[model samples]
Target: MNPATRSAFPGFAWSLSRQKTLAECPRRYAYEYYFSHNGWLADASEETKRIYRLKKLTSLEMFFGSSLHNVIQNAISNYSKSRKIPRPDDLVRLVRSSLNAAYIDSTRHYGLWFDKPSRYTMFRDVYYGDGLPPDKIEEIRSRIGACAESFPKSKTFREISGGRNVRLMELERFRTLPFADVDVVVVMDIVYRDRDTGRWVVADWKTGKESAEDRTQLALYAMYLQKLYDIPSIRDITIRNEYLATGTWREYKLEPIDVDNTLYVLERSVMEMRRYMEDIDGNVPYELEAFPLTEYTRHCERCNFKELCGR
Candidate 1:
């Protein structure tokens, strides 16, 4: 596709998240990246408008994950700059405050668009749900507190926090690697160079359950860094997923074959997305048929487009 046409669609760049969305549900992917591309136009179609609205949907789990990530990010950032970690209580307070703001924003703006509960409401339900005692709030607070406190004490944290042998990469920095015909975007949660071993360490903070996709995401980051720095081999990069919820860590070392597989997956994903968006006749409008709702009903359960799909 030409640059203009590519720019008109959502899968133009092959980020891991974009690939996952396309894999989970092409219709959802199209709604998010394709149809919604022109959603804000005054004369946009009803389908476009609907997809645009559904695209704004968020879950409590996502909010909680993002809030936790922010806390950890801030803690590390503070330590990296000042050589001091925030108190656990202060970190918990930060999480609470950030979550509260997000809750208010969701309730006031995006809550009415979806049939599901608002973020604030979901938080309350979980905090006060039946079959659980009033200590639910304390349980959550304790987990957040512990997770924050544990970060500064981790071996990896110590290595990258500040030392003569290591250099910290700015947190939340976006880097892109150009492949075949697309750019793969990756934003690492934390990355640093180990001067002693001449190795690059990349870590992503996760507050959710572990999944196979985590490996794929890390592999992509490794590939991007390799290309970005012109590293001689993928072996020089190490990937880690720091699961904050349970203070568990997963590490990965990418093989040349793994990088090959990651590239293949990305190329195939892009090809499939392009096939889904094929419009031979310039006169034809983008249709629901172009991106069909997934046959897998289970995926629709938590999908924001469930109501839109009449499920």
Candidate 2:
């Protein structure tokens, strides 16, 4: 262990994913770290522009998410219509206002995936699965419907917990210490205390489909949370995919072994990042990972990064 790794605070300093990325390739790290560039070439080719255009239509999917949010907000408002309990209507309005503000904030805001319409439609439609048996399709649709109906009322916190992007933890002994070295930080969606089990949970909001790889991301998040917060016996953690296209939410849990594996990976990543930062060799031009942006699944067609990735 590096001597600098020993902190008066018991938990880890950075999220595992952030550390992992830094270790994977320092040039990629520089782009993501200091520059805040997600490998996006603002001045893109015509083909990339076309793909971006098609992607814009998928913003239409927000119609489904906002429609359901409105429905649930209405339900909550009606539920509290008789009494003084708070409602989700304000939150819905706030989200809408923020999105509009973001649109206005952009200098040349065309929209998401502006170049690829058929790809967007095909991706969504296929995920909805035309080849499935009629009964199976109905069952899947019904599950999505149920999720749309139940999500706003289930395990919801009044306000997005931990605030916006970065959470602040006050170390009692380090009250006077200025945090100068900390540049990158991770923001999670929700934190839950199970009603029946009395266990702590960290829930991340995913707007895409769930996969085993997504579980790995959650484990990394959980391990960082445990290390940072000094929370122990932190067993059950989940990544909840609130699908925008289908108006559904699915939960994926992280097992103990997965958490341990992620931490092992994380520690090694941190050590490598520290080493790369100290390297004084000849200037090495930074290069983003070639496969890092590759379209691993059909879903890659929908990614905003697909054009930059040359997928």
RMSD to the true structure for each prediction, in A, is 5.3, 11.8
Q: Candidate 2 overall Cα lDDT vs. reference? A: 0.42
What is the C-alpha lDDT profile of model 2 across 234-284, one tens digit per residue?
465444545433454556566777766765665565555555342323212
| TM-score (all chains, Cα) for each model | 0.81, 0.43
1-311 in candidate 1: lDDT tens per residue?
34344444443566878888888888887666667665544465777666665665555566666787777777777887788856777877888887677556554534442333222333323222332234754566666776777666665786775565898876446767788777778878888898888989998887667998999999988887887778998998999988766778889899999988988998888777667655522212267666778888788866766656676
Q: Give the TM-score of candidate 1.
A: 0.81
Tell me which residue pairs clash in candidate 1.
Answer: none
Q: State, as a TM-score between 0 and 1, how close model 2 is to the true structure.
A: 0.43
RMSD after Cα superposition, model 2: 11.8
